[model samples]
Target: MVPMMMLAAIMSPSAQAQPAAATIESRAREVVALLGGTGDYDATFAPSFRTAVPRARFDAIAAQLQQALGKPTGVAAIEATGPWAAQIRIAYDGGTLNADLTLDPGGSHQIIGLLAKGAEPRGPAAQTLDAVVEQLAAQNGTSVFALARLGDGSPRLEKARNATTPIAIGSAFKLVILAELVRSIEAGERKWSDVVTLDGSALPGGGYAQQPKGTQIALRELAERMISVSDNSATDILLFHLGRAKVEAMLPVVGFTDGGVRNVPFLGALEVFKLKGVDGGALGTRYLAMDAKARRAFLDGPVRDTPIAAIPRDLFQNGKPLRIVELEWFASPNDLIRAMDWLRRHMDGTAGAELRAILSKNPGLPDATKHWRYVGYKGGSEPGVLTMTFLLQAGNGAWYALTAGINDPARDVDTLKFTGLMNRALDLAAPR
Candidate 1:
């Protein structure tokens, strides 16, 4: 988790200074009421608003808001900034919601914009830890280590089911690189503004592929891209700069030393594809047999420029005769949360702020703010593996680390099922 000192205070609308229209608050309340009562809510929208958000989409957003915040009780506060713009706080059966609503320009009361602001309550969570554990057990071949604490205190709920065992964590391993960079910055070794040159590497996604070579990007930008979008080339650049030894040493530095997760010769996106493309499915055996130096030689030698296009698509599916356990980066749920704790404890000033800002850039789910005062999340997914980890702060100023991973060598872990489950777990663990 990024340190609290790094996060900037979220700005609220000025209440007393701005002059508000007489009907502004009532208009906002009417909009909420129309959503609850239904009929053709789209009829209230301006032409542009209707074009941007169709009736079905508007209906979906309304349903989600109701599910997340419950029935709208009343408007608690309102600050109209313009003839159309108004900031409001609404009370609901679930909790209080902060929103910004804009009425259409002209004479129509059509809603131009309706955005939920700040954090709202997720109603009440499950009372007992057993209920959460039961849900975890229901999913086969899944492991989770979830512990929520109150402002750096002891865990309120710490439950581990096969949590000590390590599994392939996909992009979640990027956190290690982030942690190492912070350590370097704090030690006077590197500055966040330091710039580095980019060499050619065929990264997996379109995120970084379009950038020209010799781009002379700063370290901070690279780190942000790596974490926020899981940019492959950005990660490889950092990996090459840090070298294999420093990354390997990170396992023990962050307290992941119980042999649950291995530390040496980390794989970049290209290298991962190379391993998956090996003939006769012997990639894991071939790579595991070599020492760190030999592995480095192979990575640079044959697979250095391996492009994403070269790898077979079927190789990614479940039961493809590949050894994901040995081939990919591994970490247990417990190991990840421990590292999150370390990051939280060490975050300071600019470096911490950079990481926190990057984390908050994730286009979040609609109900995300309802449960957390703030959330820093990074998720990793592939064919047979899925992981979601969060560093959270509650409305009452408590902190939490909630992590879950699902693996199925037999088939792909259902993405929606696991994601929904983890979302519920996060809501359940929110500070009361």
Candidate 2:
């Protein structure tokens, strides 16, 4: 956590000086051009040089660009090009435009260049992006996760954990449900005030949220519970309303291939079964025969498989036994960043306000703020699986994407201890 003294020092009035108009204009134009637009450039130049630009700002910028560009653009695909420079690209009406910008120590900055069409990057920025990806892949994990930051339209750090391999997102998959709920509300399919009842049977064992019997809650309140509290009952209820088929069908539209929620809420164990008797009857046969060996195979496999039993055949499986049903909630580091990008784009509108309301209600903030700086996150845990991902908007506009998952075959691993370690990793990953 940034010390209170430091926070005060950074927030002090003297530290708050607007950059020269030329510099601000340059940066603004660069940001607009990178976003493929030049309209309504509203930005706040923080007084404290030490103050990181709020993640909310980046989200706002992304949202504006999406509105201008009329489609989803690569807002999170930004990376640092130098100690103080970055690059990004935005898809425009008929083509793509790339912009590179640089920030000076005094917050004075310039939009170095804006290409009419997207250009293939070369030189230092590209090299830096490649290097970051390699470094993330080398982390002590079996899965692949990468994060990139673009300044002035140049790639800085595109690091990956395993890069090529995919892992189960576990409870992080709830984000998909959250996104769907938001979409439904926006489409008039549902309303925030629509009351949904939660029954005891909907609860997942060992998960957070006590099963409140016959509890009546608004759909929006349930969405908040699903995300802020990681409530299994809320998620199950939302999933039922959204319909497994509708949710599964939406993944491809968002550039996800390997994520989808199973009809069953807690299918962690059932995911490994290639074939299981629906009733677990006499004709039943476990796909891998042994859970231990099956888990080993899953961990070792280059591409993880989602069991048909976990996701129903009619909803997800297209007939093949090993047909993968990637849950929208399961995000790679890139996926998390993408989701954050999406959230950032919608943050300025009703959707953004709703998300902010939900985020403010998250329980992790009070405790997590103790050691971390600018932590906006959603985490989920269950036996054998622990997942947490965040879009850590740094004290500078610099942002870091952190997702940590541990599929511990040994159920003895301490969750609190693991969360602490993950926090440490996040600290290390944050800009000094």
* lDDT of each candidate versus the true structure: 0.65, 0.45
Which portions of model 2 miss their true places by more than 4 Å?
A: 1-145, 150-157, 197-215, 258-331, 363-374, 410-417
| Deviation from truth (RMSD, Å), model 1 | 9.5
Kindly list the per-residue Cα lDDT of model 1 for residues 1-432, writing each as its tens digit. Answer: 000001112233354223235456656667668657655565665665564455655565566557766787778788764555666777878766666666654455566666544335554444555666666667766656566563454344466666667877878888888888888887788998998776765665424555777878888988887876567767878877877568777877775654343656677766786777766445545777888788878777766654555666445532232556667778876777777777776656547877677666652333455789877767776666777778787898777777778776766554434554565677677767
Question: Which 10-residue window in model 1 sums to the lowest lDDT?
Answer: 1-10
lDDT of 2 by residue, 1-432 (tens): 010011011222333333333343445444544344333233423332212223343444444335434543334344343443444444444323344433443433322222121222222221243444443334333434455453333223455564333455556766666776767776777777888766644233212235466877787777776776455556767776677556655554343444323322223223223233233321123333335446345423411233233433232112111212222124455555555555544456656677757754542422344444455677654334455666556666665555655444333123333443454455456565
How many clashing pairs in candidate 2? 43
Stretches > 4 Å off in candidate 1? 1-128, 150-157, 259-261, 280-282, 305-309, 313-322, 363-365
Clashes of each: 0, 43
lDDT of 2: 0.45
Model 1: pairs clashing at backbone N, Cα or C within 3 Å: none
